[model samples]
Target: MSDNITSNNPSLEDVIAEAVRSGLALVHTSLPGVVVSYDSSTQLAMVQPIVRFRRRSTSTGSLETYIPPPIPNVPVVWPAAAGGALTLGMVPGDQGQLMWAERSTDEWRKTGAADCDPRDTRRHDYGDAVFVPGGRGADDPLPADAYHATATVLYGATDVLLGDSTATDKVALEPDVQGQLDALAAVFNAWIVVPNDGGGALKAALGVLTAGGWPTITGATKVKAK
Candidate 1:
C-alpha cells in the first residue's frame, strides 16, 4: 500500500514547493522602487516597484514574464523627531524602497493618532506602502566629496548647504562670507588717509570711513542654509 501511494503521488514534493512559493508571494514587504511622482505638500508618492513579479506567460507556458505595477498614494518617509523634520526633494525617476505596514494604515494615516485602530483587516497590503528615498543601485553610486567625503549633504551637483541654525539665525555659507569680507575690507580701506585734505587728517580719515553710510555690512542676499 505504501509503495502504491509513492508511485501514485510522485510529485507530492513539487506540490509542497509550489504551495510555499504561492504563500510567500502573498506577503507584502519591502522592495526597491522608482518614484513615478511625488507631492511635496502631502508628502506622498506614486512608486513603481523595480523588482518585477515573475509569472508564466499566457502565450508560452514554458516562459515567464515580468509584471510591475505602480503603487499609488504611498507616504514618503522623512527623518523627523522632537518637532523637527528633514525632508528631501524626491522627483520623478528617483530610486527608493517601498515598505508596507504590518497592519492597515488607513485609520492612522487619516487621523495621525497614536492609538488608532486599523480601519481595514488587511495585513501587509501594498496600499499601506511607505517610500524611503535614496535606494541606489551599485551602478549608480554616490559621489564622494574631496574634503567631507560621504558625510556631506549635497544639493544638486555643485551647491551644498552645510550647517543649520536657530529659528532666528541662519548658517551663512560661501559667497555671503566673501561678501561680508569685502564689505569689511572696504571699511578698512577708507580709513587710510591721503596726507592732505580740506579738513584735518583725523577729520579726513573719519569722513572716508563714514562715506559709505557709516560702514554697515550690506547685501549678502543669496544666503541659504540648512
Candidate 2:
C-alpha cells in the first residue's frame, strides 16, 4: 500500500476558499463579544466590539495623577484618526522615553531627577540607554536585538458607524459585519505577526477591502452621542 494519502478529488479553488474560510472562523472563535460584518457589494469586512469609557478624576492637594479609563473591551479595529497615518517600525526597547517626543515639542527640556547635570545631557539620549533590567554603564548602547516591530491598522468609516450604535441595528448589521470581520482577521493572521515588518501585510489587507467596492472611509472625527 502507498504511504501517501490522496483525497478522491479536490479543486484548487475549493482548497483556497476553505483556507480563507477556516482562517476567518478561527479568529471569530478566539475573540468573543465582537461583531463582524462583510459587504459583498464592496468586498469589505468590518470588525468591532462594544466599548465604554467612564470619566474618572481624583484630587490631591497640589499634584494630580490622571489615568485614562481602561478599555473594557478591545476594539475590533484601531481608529486611524486617533493616531495619524499609523506606521509600523522597529525601535529600541529602551526607547520608551523617546516615544513621547511626538506628543510634546519641548519634551527634552522637561527636567527630572534623571536629568541633573549639564554634562550629563549626553546620557539622556536614547542611544545611551540599556534595555536590560540593569547594565554596567550609561555609554553601553543596548543591543539592537532588543528592538521590536509594531503593528498598526487605520480605522475606517465602518468602525465609526458601529461604535455609534448598540441598538437592534447592530443585530441587523451582524451578518454583513461578521463577514468583514472574518475577512480582516483572515488577512491579519496571514500577514500580521511577530518580528515586526507588517506594513506589507496591512496594505494587502486594506487592499482586499478597497478592491471589494466598499465605500471610501472618511470623516473619522470623534462624535459624542446626544
Candidate 3:
C-alpha cells in the first residue's frame, strides 16, 4: 500500500498536504446527495464550481482570489467577496507557524492554526549517543544477530526499518520515548519496530510507556498513556 506520508521531499509533502487541506466539510450543501447542516459558529464553505479566478502573489506568499469573482453558490456558505481565493500554498499564522487557510475578501484568511505534517517514512533519526550495553568499549558496536529474545521483548521491537519508502508508517516519538527506543535498539537486536500508521501508533506506544509496564496493544485501548 502507498504510504500517505512516505516522503521527506518538501515539494511532494506540500502536494499531499494541499490535497488533505482541500477537504471542506460537506455541511449545508444544497447539492444533491450531499445532505449536511451548518452551524452558525462554523465558517467553512464549499468552493462554488465554475468561478473564474486569477492567482496572485503576496509579499509573503501567493493565493488565488475570487473577490472580484464574487458570487454565491448558496446562501449559507458564501464565498468571501467574489469568491475568496484558496491559498496557493500553506500560510503562516499569527505566531509565524505554518498554517492552512481559506480565501476571504481577496485575502487568504486562516480560520484556524496550521502546521506541517512532520511524518515521513523515508527518514531516520540516529540519536547522538549509541546504545551498546555491555560492550567491550564505546566503539565496539553490537552485532545485528547478537540481540536475544529477552532483549526484543523488553523493547517491543521485532523488525528493522531501513529508512526508505519500504519503512512505511514510521513513528515520530516524543523526546523521552525516542531516547528509550534508541537505547533499546542497541540491545533489541534490530532497528526498532514502528507502527504502520501515523501519530496513532506513537500515541499507543506512549500509552504502553505510561502504563508502567510492557503491554500488548491488541486494539485502541492503549491510547491513553501520558
Say which candidate scores most in TM-score.
1
What is the lDDT ranking, best to worst? 1, 2, 3
- lDDT per residue as tens, model 2, 27-91: 31111112234332332223222232222123321222332222121211222464342211211
Ranking by TM-score: 1, 2, 3
Candidate 1 lDDT by residue in tens digits, 72-124: 99999889877677766578999988998999999999999889988689888
Q: Between 1 and 3, whose TM-score is larger?
A: 1
Q: Which pairs, if any, clash in model 1?
A: none
The residue-by-residue lDDT of candidate 3 on 109-205, one tens digit each, is: 2222254333332222111111111213335545656577556521222433333224444344366465666544544453355667665655555
Please, what is the whole-model Cα lDDT of each candidate in the order they appear? 0.71, 0.34, 0.32
RMSD of 2: 32.0
Q: After superposition, how far is residue 81 of candidate 3 from its true place, in Å?
A: 33
